[model samples]
Structure formats: C-alpha cells, structure tokens
Target: MSKVAIVGVVGRTNAGKSTLVNRLVGEKVSIVSPVEQTTRNTVRGIVADPRGQLVLLDTPGLHKAVGTLGTLLNRMARRSAAGTDITCVVFDASQEPQLEDVGWMQRVAKEAPDRVVFVLNKCDAKPFFSSMFREAWKEASTTPQPSPVKPVWVDCCALTDDGAKGVMDALFDFAQEGEPLFPEDVVTDYPRKLAIADTVREKFLSKLHQELPHELGVRVKEIAEGNGRWAVAVDVLVNRPSQKPIVIGRSAQTIKGARKAAEKELSEVFGVKVSLELWVKVEPNWMKNPKILEEMGYMGAVI
Candidate 1:
C-alpha cells in the first residue's frame, strides 16, 4: 500500500520553519528571511521519499496578534495543526521556549495530542529548551477535556544541514499507508503567481530590517506576455509615507536592485522572461483592518 503523511511545521517567528521545509525538499520552495513573520500563509512542499510521500505544510509563525493580519496568520498556523497527520512544533534552540510556546501546545493538545512532535530547531546555536514537554504533559494529565495522544520529541537544525535528514526520517514514520497526496515529482504546490508574490515579499524581508518587514505587503497586479517574456507589475504596500524613501533607497537604487533580484527568481520559477514593475503605496494600517486583511487572502477559521 502507498503511504502519505501530512506534516505541519510550525514555530514562532524566525524559528526556521521555512528553512526547514526548503532543506527537506532540497529546493528553495519557501522564501527564507532573517526577519520575523516572513511567511504570511501556509507553504506546502512535497517530499517524495522512497518509503512514502510526505506532504510538508510550512505555516506562519505563531505569535500574539495586535492586528487583523496577525490574527489571520495565527489562524492559518493553528488550522494546519488541526488537519495534519503529524504536527512538528519547531522551537528555536538558541533560547528557551517561551510561555507562548507552552500556550501554543496547550491549544494543540486539545486537538491532536498524539500527532504532535516537539522539534527543537536551530541546534547549531546555543542549546536551551523550555521544559515545555514536562509542562505540556502536566497540563494534558490535568485537563478535564479528552486529549488526542502525546507527541514525541525530535531535535534538529535547519541550518548547516544538521540533523535535518533524521527529522525527515522521524516524520515519515507517522504517515498512513494510503494513496499519495500529491504527484511524486511535485516539490511545491504554490502557483506561479503566488510564488512570484512570495519572491517579492522575501526580497523585501531579506533587504529590510527592524519594523520594515512587518509593515510591508506585496501584491502582483499584472502579468502579461511581452516579446517572448512576461511583464509583471507588483504593488508593495506599507503603512506610512516615511517608509517609502527607505525602501526605495538612495536614488531608487535599492528598490531597483530588489526588483531585479525578484525578477530573476520569478523567471526561473515560471521558466519565462519576466519584466517587473514595482509601485509603493500606503495602506494606512492595513494590518489592523479586518476587511483589508481578508482582502489580502487572510481568511477566517484557518485553524
């Protein structure tokens, strides 16, 4: 019988969720950034192993939400947790897991207890783990509501290729012997348009630091065929006018450089020539507006 595993990779912002997915798939399917909350939605990567096919669902980092966008991202992460066959709770090893991690687990414990796996990521850095496991067990035993089952612990590093393959091996054990979930050759399920949008967003995250990453959003407004190429227009939304100058950089050189880099990646992903147009506009605290958040593909009940 064939086997398929729906594995949810989740963690706090900058916890290497996307990096781990890319490492597992042996490709840059998900965009990686040093900034927090780089991933705004669920990024799926399909790993075709000899034993079974594992569908990896890389979700946005779980954190406190002060706005509609934050809430939507949290919902997406939780939703992936509920539906997965195995949940990989990725925690940064550089620091102890915070109270929020415990809380995240408590919520998941109520749903699929046994399907969870506590992954201590970034092991190459300083090693500090929250006694999250002990605390989680205590909470599970004491809680009045029935829990699914207890999860296992798998520690590894997404960078430097440390222990990542072992983590993949551990994840494969959770798959059910059923039909393949996706085509064997497919590495990622993201559409070309969405993928381009992600590339633009990633370039922004990697280039911008501090609050800039969180304040920015990207939308592909147009994609048209040119002479043997595709002409693309993208809108980069921000919350303030002051931020525009910084993103545009001195003489618009920085933004121009970012645009060129984004275009090259888009061309590779779509296998066609890409012409990119970038525009900056103020959305006026779009993160806080529920309606705006929904319009940006941040939906309800993702968890």
Candidate 2:
C-alpha cells in the first residue's frame, strides 16, 4: 500500500514558507515575495516517490488582521492546519523571533496540532533565535501534545534546497497508509487565473518598497491562447487615486518594468510565450470590498 501525508505548512509573514514548499515539491507552484502575505490561499503541492506521496498545503503566513481580506487569510492559514496528517510551522531562525513567531507557537500550543513538525527555515543564515525557537517548542510541547507523535525538528534552507530533503523524509516517516490523492505527475491544483494574478503581483512587489504591496491587488482581467503565445491582461488595483502613480511610476516606468518581468516569468511557468497587458485602477478601500475580495478568491469571506 502506498502511504500518504497531507502536510499543512504555516508560519509568520515572510517566514520562507512558500519557498520551502516549492523546494520540497521540486517545482514552483506558489508565489513567493519578500512582501508580507504574498500567499493568500491554500495551495497544495504534491511530492511523489516510489514509497509514498506528500500533499503539502502552502498557506498564507499568519499576521495581524487589518481588514476583511487579512482576517480571511489568517483564518485560511489556521484552518489549513486542522485535521492534516502533519502540521509544519516554519520559523525564520536567522533573526530574533518576532511576536508573529511567538503567536504561532502559542496557537499550536493551545490548538495542539497533530503530528507537528517545527521547521527552522533559513539555516543558511546564522540562527540567532536558535535557543528561543527550541524554547518555544519546549513550552508548546510541554502541555499535552496534539498528537501522540512527538514533534520532529528540522533545520533547512528553503532557497538553496539545503536540508529540504530532511523535511520530506521526516514527513514521509510519519505518513499514513493510503491511496494517492493526485496523479504522480501533478505538482499542484492551484487555478491558472489566480496563478497568473499572483505572478503579476509578485513582479510588481519586486519593484516597490514599504506598504505598497499590502495595499495593492492583482487580477487577471483576460487571458487568451493563440498560435504560439498567451495574451493576458491584468489589472493592478490600488486603494487610492494617489497610489495609482506609484504603481504606474513616472512616465509609466514602474508598470512597464513590472509587466515585462511578469511576462517573462509567466512564460517560463506556463511553457509558452506570454504577453501581458497591465492597467492600474483605483479601488478605494478595496481591502474591505466584498465583491473584489470574492473576485480575488477570498472564498466569500464575510469579515
């Protein structure tokens, strides 16, 4: 019988959770950015081997909820952890543990996730919080564990694939005997349109700093395939008219830069030449707009 593990990967914002998922699965199925909350949905990336398969759910990094979208993303992250075969909380141990890191530790302590794994991501960098991370584990695991299985710890660098295999091995060791949930060749089940939107947003974020990314949203307005290339149109949604110029930049340099980069990456991902058109529109207070949120795949989150 083939064994299977449904693993939920969670962490604080920019904790390298998405990078970890892509590394483990041996493919890019999640959007990664330095910007906080780049991942806003539960993306499942499958790992296949002769012995078993692992379904890794890469979720939004937990952070303080500021609006309906923020609340929904947090809930989605926490929700993805529940009832999984294993829960992996990734920590950026390179720096001191932030309140968000502690928040996850406290949550797992109280909620007691089953078959937990504590991942010290970014092992390539000096781990200043090494002791604190261990201490957090001791504190959380002190109370009744969510599962009889003692939590496993692995230190890995998500970007370089260093120690990433150890994480996969640890998960496979604890997997349950079951049939595969997806085909062996498939890497992810994320929607194509949303993936395009995320691709655009990621490139856009790469060009900016500060709170701009948090205030912007990307939507694939249209997509069409022809002889040898994909014609895609995207809208960059800003919260205020004042913010529009920032996205488009002086003489449209920023948007042009963002578009070219996005198209290049999108082509590589989709295995076909891609052409992207970008437009910036101001949607005041879009974070609170239910219709826009739903369009962005917030799952009808009513907060």
- For candidate 1, the lDDT comes to 0.79
Quote each prediction's TM-score. 0.90, 0.93
Backbone clashes in each candidate structure, one number apiece?
3, 0
In angstroms, the error of model 1 at 147 is 5.9
Q: On residues 17-125, what C-alpha lDDT tens digit does candidate 1 reach at each position?
A: 8999999988889999888788887888998878888888889898888687887788788788777788888877677656667776677666664566778787677
Measured by TM-score, the strongest candidate is 2
Clashing pairs in 2: none
Best by lDDT: 2
The TM-score measured for candidate 2 stands at: 0.93
Candidate 2, position 81, lDDT:
83
